[model samples]
Target: MCECKALPIRFDYTPKGKVEALGGDLEGYVVAGTKPAAIIMLYDIFGYTEYPQIKQVCDHLSAATGFTVAIPDVFRGKPWSMAKSPAKPEDNLIGWIQSVGSYAKVSSDLKLTVDFLRARGAERFGIAGTCWGASIALTACSQPDGVFEACAGLHPSLFGKDKEFAEALLRPVALVSARGDPLETVQEVVNGKPDLAPKCIWKRMDDVEHGFCAARGDYKNEVVTQRVAEAVQLLAGFFTSNVA
Candidate 1:
């Protein structure tokens, strides 16, 4: 896995429009490359980090696709420890705030992020999110075509919340999951939708659990990684096919 610190590109953008209330500067690292193939990666419930696994996603995806990637910090300067859910109720709220912000906040930030990328030569843009971020990616894709042309949701945790929401998407999507995961069934909704343009759905490695990206640890699945890389390729292909 490569280091997140290794990438040298950076961008600071002020979120505009209705998202201004959730207003905060969006920060992301640009892996410098040519010809404007950009991917905006959404993080898990854990948020963006300097973590090896997170960095590996960016590094491998860039190496495989030759696309400039930028992963934004959505926690607005919070640390990653907030996801630690304790048995006590008081501890839970602190943990929740530390980890997941309000859904509106996340959606707004993402809208701003996509807009910013589009302004900065990201014509072939796609969204990829893991776990909680996968749900966020779904919401962002539901918006009437502006920012993201495609979305890839991995081990998504919130795909079945509202059927109407799933019905609203007008883009291409790819969903990856495992059988033991709680959200495995959720991927079905995204898959079943005929309204979505280009689609790929999989729940391979049936025995794997939630947080497969991290839980699997150093023993990464080359096949699954290749699948993800292929999804990015398809997503970039979708953008080229549709937007270009």
Candidate 2:
């Protein structure tokens, strides 16, 4: 995956879920549910509250699909320090990715989150992520050893390596992308592999910017919110049908 820079984000809405411990040193905001399954919702590098929409989207998914969504604090207590854009040279995004957002580290956290859900009586599992988090989620889905049964990536920032991720997918995938994303790469792969097409859902929100589906989205704009709702519908539909 390539390094991504931070853009503007909005925390215009309040999150409805409560923060709780996910066993050991892990803690995250979990949207309560009555279903027997759970979906692990990973946030972008900005962490949870920096983009309140991350948690809000989890709440929406719970309400829509009745799946208890676990939005883990993958960054723990320390999210990205640069609150505003135009990052200084000292606040390097790649450096943070190599540490807090590294694949080895987040993949371990993903396993822990799945373990916590399994302990909570969740018999089935799915994984979803936005922006940088999507890279991690897709990487896990691509591996046969990964615990998730299905995965979703919203406005994923894969540095144009969608073909690599697509070919390596060991389970179903749902990609809800922005206009700027590399949608055609995966499209071409699935076109050749007819067996893989049914296991995937690719959607593009043409009106929104790169981070529209994640917290970096400005929900203050009516169009962005509407498109986000569409994204939620696509994700909820994918997990409900594929996670079984």
Candidate 3:
């Protein structure tokens, strides 16, 4: 489960993108750039509207990687909560995923996002997801007719552990795992598998929690900032090398 209250809202950094409709009535924050390779960034359980940090992270990745990043509103307009802590269990992090139709609905929405980008002249694509979003990214890349060229999962949760999921990775993938996360088990599986090893890059962040990548003012210490920078650099390199 993610600690939603760990990070504080940052009002200083405003997002550079505009929320536009991407067919199927789904809207996303599209950050325009010059790169031919576009990346579809899936949001965590907090959804897009819950935190400004999520949008800021999207902006940073778009500028840093030079990839036209699009963050689809997977929950449509309904986010779990903007409050640091939810008053009810149904509104908590775990309950929110259950309420939003989970991976099945998110994966369906991701396909629409891919089509939207494809129509906009994006030649290549990299799909990156965090936490609950990572599960959807993994599933998207697993499909035989999947359009993404590269996929990344940062501090993933609710990932499939079966052999089929491992065998379905058709392109390069970077898995950024936090220490002590159950997601590390899948990271180990991807690392140990002979067939998956050549294109798989597993990076484990020591002494950090799941939500460390997102810039949180509350947790903005030197070490957290460094880890976030390192994670961004790693993803930029992974997308550059794999998506061409």
* Best candidate according to lDDT: 2
Q: What is the C-alpha lDDT profile of model 3 across 1-244, one tens digit per residue? A: 1111112223465678899898788999898866677899887766666465567666666666677889898888776554644336554666557667476667778778878887887889889888767767777777778788778887766545534555566666787877754445555567666765676677888768776664222335666666665666677777777774
Runs with alpha carbons beyond 4 Å of true place in candidate 3: 1-11, 82-101, 159-168, 192-195, 215-219
Ordered from best to worst TM-score, the candidate numbers read 2, 3, 1
TM-scores of the candidates are: 0.68, 0.89, 0.81
Q: Against the hidden true structure, what lDDT does model 1 obtain?
A: 0.54
User: For model 1, how does the per-residue alpha-carbon lDDT over 1-244 read when each residue is reduced to its tens digit?
Assistant: 1211222211221211111222247665445334465676676656544333544556545654555666677876563453453226655644573356555766666667666666666667767777667766766777785567676666665634645545656666666665544333444565676656335444444545555553232224555454444444444444344333
Q: For candidate 3, give the lDDT.
A: 0.70
**Candidate 3 weakest ten by summed lDDT:** 1-10
Q: Which candidate wins on TM-score?
A: 2
Clashing pairs in 3: none
When sorted by lDDT, best at the front, the candidate numbers are: 2, 3, 1
Q: Each candidate: what lDDT?
A: 0.54, 0.78, 0.70
| All candidates: CA RMSD (Å) | 7.7, 6.0, 5.9
- lDDT of candidate 2 over 16-59, digit per residue (tens): 68898887788999977777888998787777665678877888
Model 1 segments beyond 4 Å from truth?
A: 1-24, 80-90, 93-100, 159-165, 182-192, 195-198, 214-244
